[model samples]
Target: MELIDSAARAQQALEGELGGERMILNMGPSHPSTHGVLRIVLELDGEEIVNAWPDIGYLHRGDEKIAENMTYTQFIPYTDRLDYLAPLANNVAYAYAVEKLCGIDVPPRCKYIRVICTELARISSHLLGIGCFGMDVGAMTVFLYTFKEREKIYDLAECISGARFTTSYTRIGGLANDMPPEFLPMLRKFLNELPATIDEVDKLLTRNKIFVERCRGIGVISKEDAIDLGLTGPNLRGSGVEWDIRKAHPYGGYENFQFDVPVGTAGDCYDRYLCRMEEMRQSIRILQQAADQMPDGPWNAPEAKIVLPEKKAVLTKMEELIHHFINVTQGINAPPGEVYFSAENPKGELGFYIVSKGGGAPHRLKIRSPSFVNLQAIPVMAKGHLVSDMVAILASLDFVMGECDR
Candidate 1:
């Protein structure tokens, strides 16, 4: 009877006393829950989070500073490192920013091709996001299904840019080259095959009791908080704010395509995951329309001063050769002006602000990275949730530290 009484008291002490003692825990700079060099300092009372603080800057990437020192033309490759998962989107966004400063619009063909590139990048990003999100929440089978589709995207990227990763495929006023002849049929085949994989993934996880229980009503943030926190992309949209830079202010032929922006009703982790899934479906529609309406014309702008001359002309004609030499030695002659351009990147809004002083390089450069902004909402959303719930929340936010650190 004395032993039984002692056991009962011990259980009560663990249940009540331990819950009252506060503890400070570090989630990472290298832990899986924080994901990619992010550190979150958590104040916990037993298993529940009382407060959380997110720490960044583990990468030490100085991409903005690099842009200020180099020629405008020289910075295209660096943008690829921003959202390394969506390098094509980064390339296009950077190109648009520079083009705005130069005050030149690329050809219709160029605009259409850029749309294709950006959309492809979007699909690829969302695929990896969904796959990892499933795996993060214990739906491991979904990861394999999504990656199979991603490989085809890599194949497409390789075909177009001659590199599957970090495709420095865009210039200030145009692309590296026109799309290869084989590209369209390949794209069509991919589009046809992708939906089935998406359906398979959807069936596996969308209503799975385990996934729903883990994700639903977890890490919720209000619409007001999202906007006030300056959230963009799926995080912002998941909060039911209907804002997409592509729709609000369309650039690079996005206006021509007809597609709906996916918005979530509930501002929770599950909503964010739903937004990404619907977004991929919308991307497929946009890709089909862009492919169908692919314009026929010069892929690059005709401006000799802004766009590089044809290689054959550069080799044969003295005037063309001079233009080529000037372009290679000195960058495009940008006027003294400041411009800010933001694109609806897969992660969110990737904005570039450039101040040019009539020179090859920018006088000032700043990047408004989505991941950095999205990470700000962690403390607000994470409070009052269990420590284990963080894995699902972080994966749902779907941030890449490459861009966040940059």
Candidate 2:
């Protein structure tokens, strides 16, 4: 018997026992339910799922290979496109790798700014995660509520840097510029108002019987399986393992911030949702503390050769103008070395590995995207579940194709 026929026969028999029809279905590569360009091949007996396989790489952009020909600092802009929802996390990860290779310390104020922006990105990401998850469940009202809060975060981000999304604010050593005087007060207002909004979301979904019934025991994975499948972010935490790059590895002064890591006992969709909710609050807490303790200092690193000369200096000093022109035209020259740096992105661990050849371009660069890693577990989680439950599983995984296929 052929494998396909045997599988079909088995499905038919199961469907006969259940008094329903059996079919094979492709969930995505084009379906909105998949979130990104992911395809899940599902074997189903009526609405009950027999097995599932995840097909990826539909949106591959060759980003890693493109990084190989660009300089370390020049690669920052490209990083913004991956996981477009949290570009600063990507920027910080790539810059931290280059900084690690050069052995330079970021200023205290700069560290605070990085923390603030990254945490804001985390909140932004969680909002989308919750909103999209709600959409998957046919609850459009929850989506509106979650996205309404998301807009406030985006507006705050836009106020800080001119751009709302894909704000390339992190430079090699520090921020592109200092925070505006009004930025702090605005953020304080946001922090004060966000908790109540979060409670509203919780009231709508967290305790609802239908939402709980759909998510509670479905798509369960053990801690060992989650680790084996390379799960991270809320997915890994949902399995009751407390492994956060910020808390475990402590990059970009995350050690200085006081925050709690939320964990869940049952590795299911409901647990993942709750973990994200707790994380949003924790991100707000970190932002509040960082805002209070923000220090005063020069924004960028003091390296004339690596950092761009001041605009005022460029206008007055002939040498500064020449340096500025050269820096802009040719880009920064990184030392001949390789480094791998990872950050606690909202999804999971977003890592950048760069190989420099002491020139204006990188010899090689590779990105360890969390979306890619987290998406791999879908098949494992979706197997033996109802076909209707596949949507719940995918929503829980929260795979973004931009980051996955990059």
Which pairs clash (backbone N, Cα, C closer than 3 Å) in model 2?
Answer: 49-387
Question: Which run of 10 residues does model 1 get worst, by summed lDDT?
Answer: 1-10
What TM-score number comes out for model 2? 0.93
What lDDT tens digits, residue by residue, belong to model 1 across residues 89-108? Answer: 99999999999998899999
Residue 364, model 1: Cα distance from true site in angstroms: 1.1
For candidate 2, what's the RMSD? Answer: 4.2
lDDT at residue 352 of model 1 (Cα atoms): 92
| Residue 167 alpha-carbon offset, candidate 2, angstroms | 1.2
Residues 273-337, candidate 2, lDDT per residue (tens digit)? 99999999999999999999888877677777777776888999998998778777777777788
C-alpha lDDT (0 to 100) for residue 109 of candidate 2: 82
| Estimated TM-score for each candidate | 0.96, 0.93
Query: Which model scores highest in TM-score?
Result: 1
Q: Model 2 misses residue 98 by how many Å?
A: 1.7
